[model samples]
Target: MGAAPSAGRRLGWKAGLSAGAALLIVGIAALARHRAGPPARCAPGMVALGPRCCGEGQRLDDAGRCAGAPSRCGAGLSAAPAGCVAPGATVRIAAGTLRLGPSDWEAQGVVEAREVFVPAFSLDAFEVTEQRYAACVAAGACAALPLRGEPGVPVTGVTLEESARYCAFAGGSLPSRNQLAFAAAGPSSRRYPWGDTGAVCRRVAFGLRAGPCGWGATGPELAGSRPDGAAVHADGRVFDLAGNVAEWAAPDRPGDGMSGTHGGSWTDEAASALRTWNRRLVPVSTRSPDLGFRCAYPP
Candidate 1:
């Protein structure tokens, strides 16, 4: 009976040793495979290449590359998987000049412009919509900016106070005129956001016609209507800030007593009026169909 028990114990030990050895072999094989780089798999598809795995709706292609991964919009900005910027979130861009139209037009005309310095900051990707503004109003965070048309037609006719209120609710602040111009023109004193040329008109949001009465001439379009409207730098910021609604600048001018509006409205014709430095003074109490504002935040 003693011998039988000893034999049984020996058998158990051997079995345990075999199991441990098998597990070690498996682990070694896995480690070797991992060190050899990603396994041969389909390209442009998500796969469990090793310890890491891509999310659903993704696949590894024949080239062993992952495909269909969503884009990243960074902090404070909203974007879809494919990388679509939300209308209200601000986007940062490289520091540059805020160009203004020519000062030569003393009598009255669109001004040719050059670059001015602008500090780094972020700005709303889209103009504030009625739906968004309405939320602020309901929260008592801000008063409503008057609207002459549909709620979705872009909130217009808002005072600087109202604009600032919206920015505050969004956890940002209204940009001063200088800041606004810097965002639009960038470091270069280009006539347009992209450059100093008439061709840039197609890339910005402004009227196709000229003169103060030209307001609403171009009509408000989406934030990025122009193909080359704004360029995203290596740091993931966008530039050439025009082509939606004209935004209000901070530090209210007591002399003119009118807030500054930057970027061209749908009604502007001459490219000169759309320069970064182009300033229009509207009564703080006044709001127009073509007038709207975008908010800014510190980077």
Candidate 2:
């Protein structure tokens, strides 16, 4: 071996190595930060976080280079949306007018058809499922599900009051009849969710219809069973709009202790029930196996 170096010499050598390593690290970090700036804005599939753009599976961190592990958007927001993580939970619907009732459809009972303007809001892609509701109950946020349906089935046996509570727990509110209409019919006011006419064949809205379905059927099938079948909105996002279950909504007026349930259910086969203007008034406390609900967020 060569003669041992002096302590001062060894110390100097070690300092030089540390400084070089630190510079390399600094250089790499700088490059990453620089890359996140402009490219983030123009990049496809990238979301803007501050001045930086983030790629899939990466979100903006405090350091601002898009390497942070993302947290789920708590009630009122959606994830990047690989088709809704929970119950019909993806897609953002912009603010627009909800055509309350189409001119051609005949009004039934207390339900009326008309046009009403509503603010922007986001809605679930599918109705809330049994398993998600159970989780809410377990977390102390909602009541126990009435009868433990399948995990993928829409939760039923819930009263309007309970549905409202669940919406609150989910960081949203029961959709207004106006909001529901817009989601189903879109801005242009298509008659059926599948579009202007029944030319397109779609699976059961996937449940049962008990009356002379102006289609002839009603019953609980499964939520999300018909994946590509959710109705399309002109702007963006697909909705399980007129699916089997009727959804709860605050009636035209509130505080009367009366609410409305909209949409066709497994028991409904009336042509009017599936129409955009179908609105059935019910006591706020009423619960039915064929009625379920979704949450809505303000724009």
Candidate number with greatest TM-score: 2
Residue range 146-243, candidate 2, lDDT tens digits: 65333545788888777878888888888887888778777777666766655211333422333222122223434543333456754455545665
Error of 2 at 2 (Å): 99
Off by over 4 Å in 2: 1-88, 105-113, 199-201, 206-219, 234-236
Give the best candidate by lDDT.
Answer: 2
Q: Global lDDT of each model?
A: 0.56, 0.60
Residue 5 of candidate 2: its Cα lDDT? 98
